[model samples]
Target chain A: MYEFLTGPMVWISFGIFFIGLIVRGVRYIRGLDWKLDRVTYGENISYGVRGAVRSILFWLFPYGTRSWRKNPWFTLWVFLMHFGILITPIFLLGHNILLKEKLGISLWTLPEAVADTMTVVVIVSVVFLILRRIALPEVRIITNWYDYVLLLIAVSPFLTGFLAYHRVADYYFWLMAHIISGHVLLIAVPLTKLSHFLLFFMTRAQLGMDYGIKRGGMKSKGMAW
Target chain B: MPEGTLCNKKTIDTKEQLQALLADKSGKEYYEQMNDLDVDRKALWGVIQKSLKSRTKTWLEICSHCGLCAESCFYYLANNRDPKQVPSYKIQETLGKLIARKADVDNAFMQKCMDWAYSKCTCCTRCGVYCPFGIDTGIMFSYLRGLLYGQGFVPWEMKIGSGMHRIFRAQMDITTEDWVDTCEWMAEEYEEDWPGLEIPVDKENADIIYTVNAREPKHYPEDIAEAAILFHVAGENWTVPSEGWEETSLAMFAGDWEAAKMQVESVYDAMDRLKPERMVVTECGHAYRATVIEGPYWAGLKTGKTPIDSLHYVEWVAEALRTGKLKIDPSKKIKEPVTYQDSCNYIRNGGLADVAREIMSYIAEDFREMTPNREHNFCCGGGGGLNGIGRYREQRNIGMKVKRDQILGTGAKLVIAPCHNCWDAIRDLEEVYKIGIRWSFLKPLLINMLEVPEHLKPKEE
Candidate 1:
C-alpha cells in the first residue's frame, strides 16, 4: 500500500499540478479583455515591467512597506510559513534522494538536521496562522470553513512529516500519511486559495502597473519635475 | 479567466440601463420605497456573472483575510478598531458574498450591503496602498455600489444628486447659462484691477478649456474669478464652454454610471467643440478623476486617455509657477503654520502629491505635513458622496477623528485643501470637532499671494 501510495500517487499529483497551473495561467492572461480592463489602454509594457519589478522587490522583505512595518508579528509568521512550506518540501535530503532514484537526476540537498528543523518551523507557523484566524476579530469575521480546511490541508504534511522523523508514533504509518498529505497539497495548489502562491506574482505585477501606468505615473521623463 | 460585458458589444452602453434603475423619489418617501424594494435576483446574478473577470475573480478568490488591512482603513481605526470596519471584511460582506453566492440575496441583505458600501467606505482607495496583494476594497465597494444602484437601493441624497446631473448637467440645478454668467460676473469684478481681463467663451484652437465644478456657480462664484485671474495674469489663451462648463459628477458619486457618463461627456464635448490644445480642470478631486481617469472608460474611449490632455488645477498651478508664468510674491507668501490636505483623488489616485507640495512651497512659509502625508494620508471622511448623504452624516463625523488627530499632530493652524470635496470635508470637520483650524482652497491663497503681471496690472491704480 505504501509503495503504491509513494510511487504512482506522486506522479499523478505532480501531473495535475503542472497541468492545472499552465491552464489557469493561460486562461488568466487570455481572459483579460482590453476593453473591460482599462489597464490595457494606458499600459506601456516597459513602464509596467519596471513598476512591477520595483513593487515585487519591495514586498519581498520584512518592513518593506508601512503596512508591513505596522504589523511585525504577522510579517514574521507569514515569511516563516512561506519559507518552511516551500523550502522543506523542495530541499529535504529524502525528497532529493527519492527524486534521484525516480529520474536519475540529483540536485543539491539541505542537511538532514536543517531540513528537519524547517519542517518543525512549518508546523509552528501553521499554529500561529491558525490562531490568528481563530483569535483576530477581523480575520475571524472573513474566515469560514473553507479557510480552516485550507489551512488544515496545508499544515498536515509538515505535521505528519515531523512526527514521523521524531519517531513519536508508528514511523511507517506516519510516513505514509505525510506522503499522502504532501500529494494532496500539490494537487490543491492550483485549485484552491493556495493558488495565491503563483497568483501573487500576477496580481502584484498588475497592481504595480496599475499604479504606474494608470495612476502613480512613476516620475517619468515626460513629467516636469 | 472570467466573463464580462466584452462578449456582447450591445452591453457596453450601460448608461440607459443605469438611468432606468434610478428611483425618482427623495427624502421620506425615498427611504420608505427603498426599504421595501424587491431584489432583482436574476438580474443581480447576471451582474455577478459579468463582474467575474480575471481581475475581479482573482481579487475575490485570493484575499486570504490576513487582517493586516485592518489598521489601513480609517473607518476601522476611527470606529475604535471594530473588526467589522476592516477593509477586507467590509468588501467580503458585500461584494465577496455577492460573487460567492451568485447574489442569492434579499432586500434586507441588499440594504445592509448598501449601508456598508456607502457609509462604511468612502471609496478613497487608500487601503489599496497597504494591501499585501493590492486587492483594493475601494474597487470592490465601487463595483458593489454599481450593483446596488441597479437594484434601486441607493441613498436618498445620492439619487437626488444624480437627478440634478440629469436635468442641469451639473450636481446642483445650475445651468450652462448660470455658469457662463458667473464667469462673466467674475470677469467684470476683476476687470477693475486687471484691465481688459476677459473670461473668454468658446474661443476655438486656443491653449486650454477651463472647466469647473457646478457648485462654483451655485455657491462660490469667487472660485471662477480666482481661476480666471490665474489664467489672465499668466497671459494664456483660454476659453470656457457655455454648454458644458460643469466638470463635477455627482452621478459618479451615486453610482449612477449613466448620468456620470453624461456629466463627463459634457466636459469632453466642450473640449471637442473648442478644439483646444488641452483641458485644465478646477481644483476638485473627483471632478478631475471623473473627467480625466474613470470617465473615459465609461465613454468607451479605447485609449483610456481623455479626448485631450487634461491637467489638474494643482498641476497647472505648479507648471505656471515652474515656468515663471505666474510668479508668487515672496513677501506675500503665507507665514502661518499651514498644512496641505492631500485629497485622495488628486494625490493618491492622481499622482500629483509632489506637484501639490511644490505649490505649497510657493504659498506656505511654514508648511507642516500631515503625519502620513502624500499618497498614504487618511481620507478626510467625506469623499465618495458621503458628505451629501444625510443618513451617513453621523458616521462621516465619527470618521473625521482620524483626520482630526492627524491635523492636530501636525500642529498646523490652517489646512490648505485643494480639492472641493476635501475642502468641504475639512470645513465640516472643524464644525463637528471644533479642531480650531481654518481651511482655505488653493485658488484664494494663490490669488492673494500672486504677483500681478506688469502688463496685465491696471495702470497707476
Candidate 2:
C-alpha cells in the first residue's frame, strides 16, 4: 500500500494534472475561431503584446496595485500562502531527497527548519481564509461548502506533511497519508478552482490583448501610471 | 488665492438631494416601467447563449471570487464597503449561477438577475482594471443586459430612446425638420457673435460630418452653438446631417444589437452620402465610443475599408490645437482652479486621457487634478445608461459620494467633464451633494478661450 501510494499513485496524479491541463487548454483554444476579425480602435500588434506583457506582470505581482492596499491582510496572507504553496513542495528537503532517491535527479532544497516554517505559515493562512469566509457577512454570503472543502483540500498536504515530518504519529502511516493528500491535491489542481494555478497568467494576458491590442488607441489600463 | 478652497456658500446632503430627485416623476415612471416588463425565460437564455463567446466564457470560468475588485467599485465604497456590492458578487449571484446551471433558470431567478444587472451595476469596467484575472465585469454585465434587453425588460429611458432612434433617426425623437431648424437656430445664435457663421447642414463632401447627442437640440442648444463657434473660428469645414444628426446610441446602451446596428448604420449611411473626410462625434462619451470604437464592428463595416474615419471631439480638439488650426488665448483661460473628470468611455476605454489633460492645461490657468484621475477616476454614477434609468436614482446618487469627495478634495470650483453623461452626472452630484462646484463641457470652455481671427472677431465688441 505504501509503495503503491508513493509510486504508481504519484505518477498517476502527475499524469492527471498535466493531461487535464492540456485537455482544458486545448478545448479552450479549439473552441475559439482565431480568425474572427475583431473591429478594434487601433490595431497595433506590438502595443497589444506590450499590453499583455504589462498586465501579466501586474497581476502576478499585485502588491502595488490599489487592490493590495484595500485589504492588506488578505493581500499579505494570500501572497505568503501562494509563495509557500509553490515553494515548499519543490524545495523542501524531504521532497528533494525523494527525487534524488527515485530519479537520481535533485534540485536545491531549503533547510529543514525553513521548510517546516513555510508549511506552518501556509496552514495558518488557510485557517485565516476559512475564518474570513465565516466571519465577514459579505464573504459569508458567497461562501458555500465548496469553499470550505477547497480550503481543506489546499491545506491537507501541508498539515499532514508537517505532522509526518515531525513524526507526530506512526511514521509510516503519517507519511503515507501525506503522500495520498498531496496526490489528491495534484489531481484536483487542473480540475477545479485550483486551475487558477495555470489559468491566471493566460486570462491576464487575454485581458491585456483585448483592452490593449484589439481596443486600439488605448494605453493599457494595467500599465497606466 | 491658494488652491483647494471651497467657494460655495452652503453644504447639501447629497444623499437627500439624490433621494428627492428619485422621488420625482421620471423616477416613478422608471419604477413602473421596469416592473411592467414580461419575462420570457427561454428567450432570455437564448440571448445569453448567443452572446457567450470565447472572451466572456473565459471570464466566467476564471473569476476566483477573490473580492479584490470590491475596493475599485464606487458603489462598494460609497455603501461602506458592502461585500454584496462587490462587482464579483453581482456576477456570482446572477450570471455565474446561470452559467453553472446551464440555463435551468426560472422566471423568478431571471427577474432577480435583471434587477442586479440593471440597478446594482453600471457596467463601468473600473473594477476590471483591478481584477487579478483582468475579468471585465462590464463586458459580462453588458451580456447580461443584452439578455435582459432580449426579454424586453429594459429601463424605460432606454426603451424610449431606442424606439425614438428607430423611427426618427435620433434618440430624442427630433424630426428632420426639427433637427435642421435647431441647427439653423443655433447657427443664428452663434451668428450674432460671429457674422457669416454657417452651421452647414448636409454639405456634400465636407471635411467633417459633425454629429451630436439628441439632448443638445432638446435641452442644451447652447452646446451646439458653442461647437459651431469653435468650428467657425478654427476655419474648418464641418456639416451636421439633417438625417442621422443624433450621435447618441441608446440602443447600444440597451444592448439591442439589431437596433444598435441600425443606429450605427444610419450614421455610416449619412457620412457615406456626405463623403466627409471624417466623422466627428461631439462631447458625448458613449456616442463617441459607439461611433468610433464599437460602431464599425456592430455595423459590419471593416475598419480600413470604411468610408470615413471616426474621431472623438476631444481628439479632434486636441489635434486642432496641436496643428495651430485652433488657437486659445492664455489670458482668457478659466480663472478658478478647475479639475477635469475623465469620462470612462473617453479615457479608460478610448485612451484619450493624455490628450484630455493637455487640453485642460491649455484652457484652464489653474488646473487641479482629482486624486486617482484619468483612467483610475471614479465614475460619475451615470455610466452604462444608469443616469437615464431613473429607477436607480437613489443608488446612483449615493454612489456619487466617491466622485463628490474626489471633486471636493481637489477644491476646484469648476469641474470640466468633457462627456455629456459625465457632465450631467457630475451636475447632479453637485446639486445633491451641494458641493457648490460648477460643471462645464470642453466645448463651452474652448469657445470661451478660442482666439477668433481678427477678421472673424466682432468689431469693437
Candidate 3:
C-alpha cells in the first residue's frame, strides 16, 4: 500500500515539475533576445584555455585558499551553512543507494544522525528567515501569498521527515509521506524557483568569466561539468 | 556702465546660479508646510496613491530580496549595511507606505515611511546588477519622486537640481548670452594655436553642430577651447548654436518628463534651422543618451521628416581619425598611462564604448583599461542628480569607491572620462581617495595630441 502511494505521488510531482520548469525556462531564454544587449552582454572576449581553467578553480575555491581571514567571518558562516543545508540531503548517497538496492527502508545509525542534525539546522535557519521576514517592515511589506506558500513548501519536507523518523502516529504512514515528499522535491527541483539552485552557480560562473574579460585578463579557467 | 556691464562674466555666473536655485525649488515647500498644517490626511494620501500606481516596471518587480544588492550599493556599502541605505529598504520604507495604505495601511504609519526614500537614496542604479530580478530600484525612487512631485513635496536640493534643469535645460543655469559669451571667449583663447578658429553660432548648413555641457561654460572653459582647436585642425564644418547649445539635461535625472521634452525640442528646433548633416553631442553621457535615443520619442520626433543625423562626439572624433580627416603628430605623447571611465548612460544607453576607446588611443601614450569597463563600467558618483543635492555628500563620496578601486587597480597615472558629470565626479574621487590619477576630458587630451594648425603655426620672432 505504501509503495503504491509513493509511486503515484512521485509520478504526479515529476510530471508537473518537469513540464512547468521547461515552460518557464523556455520563456526566460526567449526574454533574453528582447532585452538591451549592451546591458546584457559585455563588449569583448579575451581568448582561451588558461582563462577557462582559472575561472573553474575560482568557482570551486570561491574565496581562494585564504580561508575566512580575508573576508568577514559572517560571509564564511553563511556560505558554509548554505552549502551544508543545500548540498547534503539533495545529493545524499542514500538516494542512489535506495534506487540501486531497491528496498532499503532504514537509515544506518550514523547517516541518520547526519540527516537529523542537518534537518535541525535547515529548520532553524528557515524559521529565522520567517522571523526576519516578519520583524523587518520592508520584507513584510513586500511579502505576498506566493512568498508564504514558498516558505511552507521549503519547511514541509524537513517537518514531515522529522516526524517520520521519530515514528509519530502511524510509522508506516509517515514513512510513506516522507518518501512521497522526497520524490516531489526531486521533480520540483528543475521546475520551480528551486532551479535557482542550479542557475545561481551558472550565472555566478558566467559573471566571473565576463568580469575577467572586461578586466582584459588574457588567461582564465572553468568547466561546468 | 549700465548696459554693457550687465553681460559681464561674474554677474552672469551669479544670475545663472540664482535662476538654477529658483527653478529647482519653486517655493513648493512653503505651500507644503501649510498644507501639512491644514489639509486632510485622507485627501493627500489619495493623491499620493494615485500617482504611485502608474509606475513603470523598475520599482514594482525588479528586486528578488536576495540582499546581494546591498553589498553593491555605495550607500549600503559605505554605511556598513545600515539597511536604510540599502536601495530596497529605502523604496520599501516610502513606496511601501503608499502601497500599504492603498492596500489599507494607516495614514499615520505612511508619513513615517516617507522619511527614508526622500532623504537617503540619491537614486543611482549602481546596485542594479546584483538583483537576481534586475530590479532598477532607482526607477522605484524616481517613481516615488514622481509621486512626491505630484504631492508638491520635492526636497530643497532636488528643487535646485530641477531649477537648473529648467532654465538652462542643463545642469547649470546659464542664459543664452552667457553661453554665447563663453564660446566666444574659448575661441579667442584657442586663437593662439588656430587663429581662424571661430565658435560659430547659428551657422546655416554646417556639417556638424556640437552641443556642450554647462560645465564647459561654468568651470572648465578650457574643454571648449580644446573642442574648437580640434574642429579647426580637422577642418570640420562644425558650429555651436547660441540658442540651443546646452546639452546636459538635469531633467533626465530629475524624472521631470515635461522639462526633459522641452529641452530636447529646443535643441531640435535649433538643429532644424542649422540643417547640419549631424549633431554631435560633446562628452556628456546622459545628454547623448537623451538626444540620440530617448529624445526622439520623448519629444514626439519621428524619423525621415525633421530628421537629423546624431552621433556621439567620441564617434565623430574616432571616425575622423580612422578616415584621416584629422592628422595627428604621434610624437606628442601624453606621457601617462590613462584608464578610461565609461559613462553608464553613454555605454549602456548610447552604445558608445568603442568610440570612447578610439578617441582615447589617439591622445594617450599608454592606455590602460579600467577593470569591468565598457558597458559594465561602474557609475561615477555624480549621476541621478546626486551632485545637485549637496546634502548627500557623504553617501555620494562613499558611493564613488567602486570607481576609485577600478582606477587604483589599473595603476594608471591618468583617467580619461568623456562625460562632464563623470569628469566632475571622478575628480572628486581622485581627491577623496587620494589616488593621484589626473582626470581630464577627451577633448583636452586630443587638443594636446594634435599638430599645430597652418594658420597659427609658430612664427620666427
Model 3 scores what on Cα lDDT?
0.60
Residue A108 of model 1: what lDDT?
Answer: 88
Position B262, candidate 1: lDDT: 87
**Per-residue lDDT of candidate 2, residues A69-127 (tens digit):** 66779988988899999999999888888888889999999999999999999999999
Better TM-score candidate (2, 3): 2
Q: What docking grade applies to model 3?
A: incorrect
Error of 3 at B416 (Å): 1.9
Best by TM-score: 1
> What is the C-alpha lDDT profile of model 3 across A45-132, one tens digit per residue?
3422333344445434535422222334433444544665566555555554654565555342336677677777767766766675
Model 1: docking quality category: acceptable
Error of 2 at B7 (Å): 48
Candidate 2 C-alpha lDDT tens digits along B1-461: 11111111111124343234335456454444444444555655666666576666777776666666777888888999888898888887888888777767765676688677877777778888888778878777877776766655556566556666666667765788998898999888778678888899999988889999989999998888888888888889999998877777887777776777777788888987888898888999988777666776777664422357777888889889988889988789888889988888878877778888778767878889998887788888888888877667888899889989999999898998888889989989988989798998888778777888889977775
Q: What is candidate 1's lDDT per residue for A1-225, written digit by digit as tens? A: 877777888889989998888877887776665555556424567766766776676787777877888889988988888888988888888888888988878778999999888877777888898898989888888888998889889999999988888888699889988898998999999999898878887777777776666665644321111
Chain A vs. true chain A, TM-score per model, equals 0.92, 0.90, 0.63
Q: Give residue B321's error in model 2 in angstroms.
A: 2.5
Ranking of candidates on lDDT, top first? 1, 2, 3
Question: DockQ for each candidate?
Answer: 0.47, 0.34, 0.06
